[model samples]
Target: MFKYVIQLILGFLTLLMSTAISWYEGSGIIDNPLEWKYSTPFSQIFNIEISSGQDISQLDYFVYAAKFQPFFPTIMTVSVLYICTVLIFFIFQLNRQLAIILSGIISCVFIVMSAIFFNSSTVGGNIFFWITAVGALIFISMGISLWYRKKYMFKFQPQ
Candidate 1:
């Protein structure tokens, strides 16, 4: 439908905007070696030593932004999730049961992600933890509302 297309376009645009902003913000770390320790989680995890900006890959910029300055990266992640959710809802609009199941599964995944970030020491980790927790709640509510509407609000009446 036209509305679905609009929502999809808006979600994609939001994702692009967030990615660009996060990339710009993350690129700052390339100039400031002092921030390297805080920004190079990928390098640390992989045991890769980054002596200069060249040692950092383009993909690492996004990772840096995600760990150190998560606002826009979070937006990017949520936007991608929203686009996927919208597509799933559209695809399963006629199958309420399947939609409900998928919603529950998605919520569970978000819950786990939130828990993973729950004890993070960085500002970005704290923010992502709360965001993912909220996402889980949203998905749970969506499933409940769909189930309620299908079960209680659409009952047939005798003519």
Candidate 2:
């Protein structure tokens, strides 16, 4: 009974973590002008400059850039991939600690970096692009390790 209870708790926690991760992601953020006012600890983490006169509408969150843009999308993609991969492992009932540790690591990096740049009080601060980029790099590192282990293992996926 105790073991089952622990498993249940673990599963729920994992799901909750996944849910939170999903929420901050691109699909999660409800492109609201209000989200612009979040004044978070990681506010000024992203530094974007408005082009000469490009009138940016609220719905333009998917924008890459006006002057130097490709960087933002590339970083955001990392967050998506990291969270999606973690979700996949979770759904498969793989190692819970592995998933949690990996996810936490990603989360921590963003949190720390975000705190350092907190409260930019600028238009670009509304977008949390740096966190996303850092997240992707972290994910890529873990993914590579998993891939190498699988490729070299004589007996992968131990039962």
Candidate 3:
């Protein structure tokens, strides 16, 4: 339990730091005309024309950073995923079966996310694709190892 708390705190701190850095990097688009084109994913997707920096939503700043400069945004994404994974593991630690099921579900979700970015032409898309693909592999491996350890490593003795 103590370890879980520590992990959660560390994850949260990482998330906060990454978010701040990403936000700062993203906000640079407001001053750089060259970045305006790279920051238009939100506008393109939502069909909203952003003629000026003032028209960009706060959330779009994150998207801008993610699209042009993926490093900090990637860290932010990984941090959030880590926090969620830790919480899920802590919640279902006592129930191996449930944990395994949840792990599989999470892995599938990651797989889908990876696929979504698989064909993206942007640097962020490539980074996200790899991140999600690796995440799927990690979750699936965790689920498999847990199942194997529970089924093969433990012998039940009748009382």
Model 2 lDDT, residue 22, Cα:
36
List the candidates ranked by TM-score, beginning with the highest: 3, 1, 2
What is the C-alpha local distance difference test score of each model?
0.84, 0.44, 0.84
**Which lDDT value does model 2 have at 5?**
51
**TM-scores, each model vs. reference:** 0.78, 0.30, 0.80
Candidate that scores best on TM-score:
3
Instruction: Indicate the worst ten consecutive residues by lDDT in candidate 1.
Output: 150-159
How would you encode candidate 3's per-residue C-alpha lDDT over 29-119 as one tens digit per residue?
7776676666666766777677777766667788778878999999997997798689767866678788888889889999998997898
Q: Across residues 1-159, which tens digit of lDDT does each residue of candidate 2 receive?
A: 454456556655555654444333422223333333342212234443333222223233333121123344434444355445546355324654465456556656666645644564433443444554455456556555555554566575578
Candidate 2 lowest-lDDT run of ten: 61-70
Those runs of model 1 whose alpha carbons end farther than 4 Å from true positions after fitting are: 34-38, 44-47, 157-159
